[model samples]
Target: MTTLYRSLRVLTPAMSETKPSVRGFHGKTSASTDLLETVGRVFLTGRARAHDYMVHVGIGWAPARVPGFRWSAVTANVTDELVQWLVLDGYGFHQAYFHPDRYVRGQYRERRFPWPAGGPGWYVDRAIDQGIGRALWFVAGTDPAVAADLIDGFAPDRRADLYSGAGLAATYAGGVERHELELLWARAGEHRPLVAQAAAFAATARVRAGLAVPHNELATRVFCGMSVAEASEVSVRTRPSGPVGGDVPAYEVWRQRIADEFRASGRA
Candidate 1:
């Protein structure tokens, strides 16, 4: 533990740098999972605790920090692949938090987001929107009505992903009461399945980390009509066998499968 702490202190900056020989970080067998989890933690902590501006840049540096990392690598860690994408989620949150006028108000999007450059690049925009949706949770101060309005302000095509992100935030972060989550469920309407899918993802994160809390249960019940364990099962059972061929990434297919299961079960 002492060595890990010291290593983290010295290599902290490398968290946001591209392929800088993160020797100490890589020394651990759990480095891949640790790195991805830390990226998400940095963003959530930055927004919820530090209110720091530079963490956004660190998130941008995330993909590069990993040596020879690729989106396809997610297939190898099927259970935790969702967390891998949280790097983009962190980036999206920071963009919205720091430059709300441009990202939130103006609704601008980088047609070609040039980072971690490679195949499956087309999915970057959607992944970022998921983060933007999570940011809306904080931007609206955890108010369900305000969150719905903020998402509604976006282009129609983007609202589903925005709601999905918010669902993840509400489930994982858990600031509001159960009634508030219910209100969010009502507002989500047609996108309820997407919201449920993201909430299930959150359940999996919490359960996997042994960080399951009352709010996780509350949110899962409200959004998914199931307990956290059951909701997590929805995520596990619906996972794509491996990488799929097409414009859509396997991650999306996994999410869609979860969403379809929830929709079919009439959870909302």
Candidate 2:
């Protein structure tokens, strides 16, 4: 390896591992993943209201050669399920920072955190924030600088909580740039509350993937280790009782299974 490559390997441990085909970022992506990515591609490339964009991209999306492809076939297939998901996801986009433990909503029932103020679009913006982050993860891969640009490029009103969600993407993407992390911290400005939430998102995924993370060495604490199986269990147990329902359990199963596949491939 070249000197620059060696230096990079030293800096970001996530860059050291090889991503194989079966466990690649695109590997075994679920219906939710495809739908989310579609939403992200449109948003990252242009400005469109969430409902409008979904209808445009998903509605009347007939294949020319397929005889009679239903308009927005996929969306039509999922029906009310997708609409409900978007609303809930939009809600969580804002709730992410307020909830502390962003992943699990069941923990928030007893707390008295107020819903964010900014009119009805608030949740849509937050959901888009997540989509943008996921898109960056898929398209930019491990390039933190590129990811940072994507997040910073958004207009301020897109969502104040964006940096936090973007930060989650950087972690879940499995690599981070020191300068990029610092830039996000700075961009967060003043109290910088959301950055810690980002750290937790990254750390939780790392632990769930069974990586031997040096949790104490980092500024943010990684959660206790959890196997993919354990996460699926928690997800199932936490469902219905919380806001997440419908296809979520199936998605979680697929996500955990794919994660296990990646981990095994990494070991190989």
Q: What lDDT does the true structure give each of the candidates?
A: 0.69, 0.36
lDDT tens digits, residues 1-268, model 2? Answer: 1232222222221311222221233332354245334433443243233233123222211221123332133223333322333323333332332232332212222122121122233334344444344334444343445445555555565434455555555444434435544654555553144444344434544454454243212323221123333433433342333335443433233324433432443310
> For candidate 1, lDDT tens digit of each residue in 1-268?
2232222233244333322122211121244334334534554333311322123323443333334444333223223343345557666866765566688778888776554444468778888898889867766656788889989999999999999999998898776777889999999999999999999988987776677899899999899999999999989898777667777767788889999998889785
lDDT of 1: 0.69
User: Mind sharing the TM-score for model 2?
Assistant: 0.37
By TM-score, how accurate is candidate 1?
Answer: 0.72
Clashes of 2: 4
